[model samples]
Target: MDRAEVTELVLSAKRMKGLTWKDIHEKVSVSTSPIVVTAALLGQMRLEPNEAAKAAELFGLPEEAQILLTEIPYRGSLTEIPPTDPLIYRFYELVMVYGTTWKELIQEEFGDGIMSAIDFDMTMERQPDQKGDRVKLQMSGKFLSYKRY
Candidate 1:
């Protein structure tokens, strides 16, 4: 089965079993964050063979679905260029407005290197406020400098 089919099966099983991503992640014992585990379930990341088997056992997935989980997926499933969803669009707008500022600050502080998403960690939390609760997004990525040819 393709990644999409596997994703559907996973979602169906999750709904039927009333399982959360955190539940599956913990049960599967995958050495990754819940968000990463969710990404794998959504067919955005590849899982190791053992991890796939664990996930299959936890989600009642078939052997073919486990195989699909271990295969590399075509990441970035967004069909639109600038996301149409309001929440996601807000991020796009933030980048449009502060992209230059972020670039300048990062370059000044970290040299001509860029942050590596491959070696990144992110967390989303709620911050208490007088007016209303605010979102706190913490992201850390390794800084990689350009290699001189």
Candidate 2:
């Protein structure tokens, strides 16, 4: 099966079993980061063989699907240019509004460098607020400087 098919099968299995991402992540317990592991199941990232086996067991996936999980995926391929989903579109909007500001700030602080998504970690949590709850996200990525030849 293709990676997309495997992903669909995984989603179906997750629904049938009433499994949350957290539930699967906890059951597999392979990666420290839930986000990374979730990305792997969503067909955006690759898992190690052992990790794939664990995920397969948890999701009742076949061996072929488990093997596909261990293969590198075409990252950022699923989303449209503008991202049609409302929640996803908000992220695109954030870039459109603040991207230049972020670029300027990063350049000023780090000097001709960019953050590495390949070596990144992110956490999301809910913040208790009096009026309403807030979503808090923390992202940390390694900075790579441009090399001058």
Candidate 3:
């Protein structure tokens, strides 16, 4: 099966078993963060051999599914340019509004460089508040300086 088919199987199995991303991650012992595990499930990352086997077992997936999981996936599943989903759209909007500001600040602080998503860590948490809960997204990526040619 292709990565897309495997992804659908993973989703179906997750729903059938009522398994959370954290649950699957813990069961598979694949990643420290559920986000990474989720990324694998969504076909954004390749799973190691052991991870693929464990995930296949946990989800009762076919043997081919395990093989498929080990293959590198075509990342970025969004079909449209600006995401149609409201939650994702907000993030797109955030970048549109603050991307330049972020670029400027980072450039000023670190010189000519860009943050590395390849070496990044991200976490999401809910903060308690009297009026309403607040979502906190924390991300840290290594800074890569441009090499002079």
Candidate 4:
């Protein structure tokens, strides 16, 4: 499927009920935009093998949709959002909320720069909480220096 078709499919999933991009963000293991994750639901975006597998089970994407997702896509923002449509915006929210901590920690670990989401690794877990199930995201990316090193 193309971008439009995929976007629709992602937004239409029963599993997606009551889920916001924020919920998905906390379940990741790396610094990626929620757009990337939510867009993946459309079967238009590529996912890591394990991630793809998980999505397949969760969303029941058709075989073609699965294949199409693995191919690099012509990316776009569904709305007037910056590098964001609906899917990616969820990830941006995390950065906006916990960005200070992330910025500080990355600076402490590497320096003043951001990590490469393209060359990153992430893992997620679900923990039972008093209020609800909490998602634990653990991510490690090869940090890139904002300036010439």
Candidate 5:
């Protein structure tokens, strides 16, 4: 089956089993980070063979799907240009609003360079607030400075 088909199967099984991404991540014991493991299952990342096998067992996926999980996926291939989804759109909006500010601050602090998404780690937590529960996101990525040629 194609990656998209496998994704569909996985989503179907997850829904039928009433499983959360955390549930699958912990049960499969694939990665320490739930986000990474979830992304692998959602066809954005690759899992090692052993990890893929464990995920297959947890999700009741077939052999082909398990193999597909181990294959490298086309990351960010499914994103819409402007992001039609509200939650995703908010993230897009954040970048649009803060993109320059972030760039300027980073450049000033770290010189001319960029953050490496390939070598990144992120965490999401709920911050307790009397006004409302706030979403706290912490992202750490390696900084790659430009090389003088």
Candidate 6:
């Protein structure tokens, strides 16, 4: 399709009933910006086969969207989602704001090998704080040791 046609579809998808971009992002499990989503709609970038299927399930995309998964995308991601995606930035911000206690704690428990995010488990909890509120993230994964034993 042409540029205007593509953009109109994107905006329509963005507008579709009771749904919000934030909600779509959560369901889709990807760090997305307007630009990323738009490009994905316009076929400038691909969603990966699995991600395309998820997008279809989440956003209820059309059959045309299937081809988009194979398309090579333009550069996506504006800011990193943690420092990066503002939604997940709380933990990193906590590190900077609260201090390196988290770092030292990890080092003490884990020894040296870093935990693999790829093979990791993640949980987010909301707990009451003395001052107000907090977003707590708990992550656990097998330690991948550098020194072979």
Supply the TM-score for candidate 6.
Answer: 0.46
lDDT of each: 0.88, 0.89, 0.90, 0.64, 0.88, 0.59
Using lDDT, rank the candidates from best to worst.
3, 2, 1, 5, 4, 6
* Model 3 Cα lDDT, one tens digit per residue, 1-149: 78999999999999999998878988876445788878988899888889889999988999999998888888888998799999999999999999999999999999999999989999989899999999999999999999999
Which ten residues in a row are the worst by lDDT in model 6?
A: 1-10
Q: In candidate 2, what are the lDDT values of residues 1-149, reduced to their tens digit? A: 89999999989999999999999888776546888888889989888888898989988889999999999998887457898989988989999999999899999999999999989989999999999999999988899999999
Give candidate 3 regions above 4 Å deviation.
Answer: none
- Off-target runs (Cα >4 Å) in candidate 5 are none
Each model's TM-score? 0.88, 0.95, 0.94, 0.51, 0.94, 0.46
lDDT of 5 by residue, 48-96 (tens): 8998898889778899999999998988964578999999889999999
In model 1, what lDDT does residue 125 have? 81
For every model shown, the clashing-pair count is 0, 0, 0, 8, 0, 7
| Tens-digit lDDT string for candidate 1 (1-149) | 78999999999999999988778888775577877788889999888888899989987888999999989899989889799999989999999999899889999999998988889898878899999999999889999998889
Evaluated at residue 124, the lDDT of candidate 5 is: 91
Task: Assess the local accuracy of residue 72 in candidate 5 as a C-alpha lDDT between 0 and 100.
Answer: 88
lDDT of 1 at 8: 95
Q: In model 6, how large is the Cα lDDT of residue 123?
A: 59
Model 4 ranges off by over 4 Å: 7-44, 47-67, 75-91, 147-149
lDDT of 5: 0.88
Deviation of model 3 at 57, angstroms: 0.8
Better of 1 and 6 by TM-score: 1
Q: Which candidate achieves the best TM-score against the true structure?
A: 2
- Kindly report which residue pairs in candidate 1 clash with one another: none
Better of 1 and 3 by TM-score: 3
Number of clashing residue pairs, candidate 1: 0
